[model samples]
Target: MKKKKLLLTTALVGTMAFGATIPTSLAHDALGSDVNKGEERIVFSNEDLKTLESSLLKGRKNVGNFYEAAAVQIQELEGVQNNTADVYAHNGYAYLGTHTANGGNGGVRVFDLKDPSNPVEIAVFAHDVPYTWQEKVIVKSVNTPHFKGDLAAVSVQQTSRNNSSRPDSVGGVLLYDVTDPTDPQKLGFYQLDRRITGTHELYLTTQGNRALVLASSPYADYYTHGENEDFQIIDVSDPSNPEKLWGSDPRELEEISEKFNGYHWDAPDGHTRPVFNHSVITDNNGQYAYVSMWDLGTVIFDIQDPENPVYLGRTEYRDDQKGAAHSAALARGGNILIETREVSNPVGDGYEDAYGYTRILDIKDKTNPVLLSEFTTELTYDIPETSQGRTTFAKTVHDPKVHGNTLYLSYYSGGVIMVDITNPNNPTEIGRYTPESANVWGVFVDRNYVLASDMGQGLKVLARGNKVVNNGKGR
Candidate 1:
């Protein structure tokens, strides 16, 4: 008996085309780890074309219309490449990340949101690194002993697994001083091992006088062959001197093994479900950290002590559920959690019948979290029978943002769907803003309006029309 080995190969197609001179040593490496395994290669086979056509047709069918109670679009700023990734709003400005889907160099785009209806592009943080992409960016106002101003942390990842050994290739987090959004000054770069690829998602928090950055390195153990941890905490209290404070692999924890009885290592579907950290978010006080583990659910950690973190309990999924646990947000004074599962392939291997949706959990009991309820939209369960087994990225929920009792979600082609989670157990859809050709990747709620990052159409400023009443504190 022999073990099955999977090798990733890149096919030249559109702007994702690769060069003919692929290094032989790098050809056998896997594309990525966990949920993003083997996604870099853009092979345009017959089946691939069929899937693309199906997604486009589905988008067209539901295009150019808004829900009766839909939020009105105030303004839209087209992206430089129309390949926007994630968006973050702070103070009176909006920052957007760039993707490598169209062979464009990754960077951070800044816009002045002072005038909500008219966002002005103020600056662009050009990422000169070749063969890499910046998919996530988060800006936080810090008042530390060394640096006290606006700090931006951007996640950088290699575009392809085969280019790991290229001299020009780089992977890690880039820090910038954006206190002056118009002229962002480079502070420092936190470099990761080449084998680890890079950080896919990041979060910044201020623990007292010390500021820290929590980075999620997806499938790091698989790539390094158990040599490194996937989640890392870096002490960025001094923007110029970024140092690693702590690192941990959730799978190696005793409580995780005992709770699931080691079932996470080898799932019942005859496939090895590798546990990896997909994304992370911390409480307002930075006392606890919630990590979104792809197949092992969301693992909680107590980080009151920056040097040492204690393992808390994690969320659980049913036997029939394909565990993704992509991203999450905290609400209701950090007692409730909004978890979004990006299950792009939803109709095979005995999985559910629809795309990913929102799951509300009561985390008041950190040691033993409880599932309160689940929220789904028409696109989540209304997949056509013909597109059941085919993989499409257009219909799944990508991110979550909460303002008061309202929950905003980025539903790719399904557009932005809003829900009223006043009752955690029974969330109801209150509003939506679906554009003519929407491919929204992220959503952010501000004091006055909401900002959505659409991959194809760029930044869209939306008004909830007094629907969002600040009855409770928002995340």
Candidate 2:
């Protein structure tokens, strides 16, 4: 009676620092989510942090969704390393991570994913903006967009890679009122006076008492240094009070698209757009706000009055903005905007559905966004060109979750994908639950549970029904 094996795909051998070298781009999934039998998942890897480090150092206290209780491992106080602690969810209980690990100098790692496979790390929003006395600079942002009725808007921009401190690039904008995710108290943080660096990515509009936050830093400086940005609008109708007002940064999108109206521009092309850190798809009643912008492609905003937002224009596909139109969706109250391409995918044949497709534009003429047609993914995998697709892992469809009409995509190694836009131009991939744990970066469905975010396997809660479906009590 012994079966709990979860060493995944190639038996994850990455512990970093313990003899160095673990990068072939992270030796594929590094032991996480290669699941098959019974299939209810969990793999918070590092071998479940080495079998839960003696039950997380015997501290207990695990409750989530907001004010993330506590468990330490604070990514070594915001310098994360090794297989690290990759966790991010926004609905399966509001969370986001990267206080360290994947990007050397990083910030922002919070949680409260209440029982979404145990998420509880309450507070530590140190992007460091002291400035005056100790001269502070590091406040890096990796997309902290949360709004399930409360507040938590984060998107810092300052990267000459960190260049050991400063080579230019710093726009550490931060705002929080998480209603109290273990006390997130920091009503404001805006340090973008242009020495470089700008808003990373945010798309929250909020109503009632009002809120704005649109932010964008498409890549702050074009190529590497930072500054091709444009996505600035912060008027936090007082979540403790924060205000920036107007915003725009579009250095003509670093100019790499020789052509983008008839197709024919592909060079490591995640399809030209690369400025908006991650996403901004709204419209399930959020009024209508879809802004992707990297190589410059998806920008359709009109947030009723979420504060002066009226850019109603953009949809200029592939002039080669260099892979950053990343992820987007507006499915439900549909006008169309389901874009993809976190890293461009078209390795033909070997059948991988050419990398989780999604391109359906035509935002009912918000200036102009009409590409209507391009979606072909139903779990196609064959990878074996010497594993050029690299050990063939999947789950980087990179964040996309909508419910009413169904969109749910987290595909880092390509798993958690379940489109069914009730026909948003034939987008019907339908039912799925494939968590063999590739790098499924962030997702949250709630009501029926789905809470994903299993990079090294940290937050994976399936819960639907049948095969032992009780979610307890209902048992």
Pick the lDDT winner: 1
- lDDT of residue 312 for candidate 2: 59
Q: Put down candidate 2 lDDT per residue, 1-475, tens digits, no spaces.
A: 1112111111111221121222232222211111110122333433344333221101011111111112223334433431222233454344544312343233455656555445565665534542111101112122223333345666554433344455444554566655555666676665565543445456555544456666654433332222223455666665445666654433222333223211122224333112333346566455666767533556565666544555556656443222335557665457667787543333432222344346767666666677867655533334345645433325225557677767777665554666666667676665444433345555666565655554454445555433322222111
Give the per-residue Cα lDDT of candidate 2 at 306: 49
- Residue-level lDDT tens digits of model 1 in 362-434: 9898877799999988778766668544456677788999888878898887777878888999988866666
Candidate 1, residue 382: the lDDT equals: 61
By TM-score, how accurate is candidate 1?
0.80
Best model number under TM-score = 1
Look at candidate 1 and tell me the lDDT of residue 35.
25
Instruction: Quantify how close model 1 is to the true structure by its C-alpha RMSD in Å.
Output: 10.4
Clashing pairs in 1: none
Please report, as a residue range, the 10-residue window in candidate 2 with the lowest summed lDDT: 55-64
Please report, in order, the local distance difference test score of every candidate based on alpha carbons.
0.69, 0.45
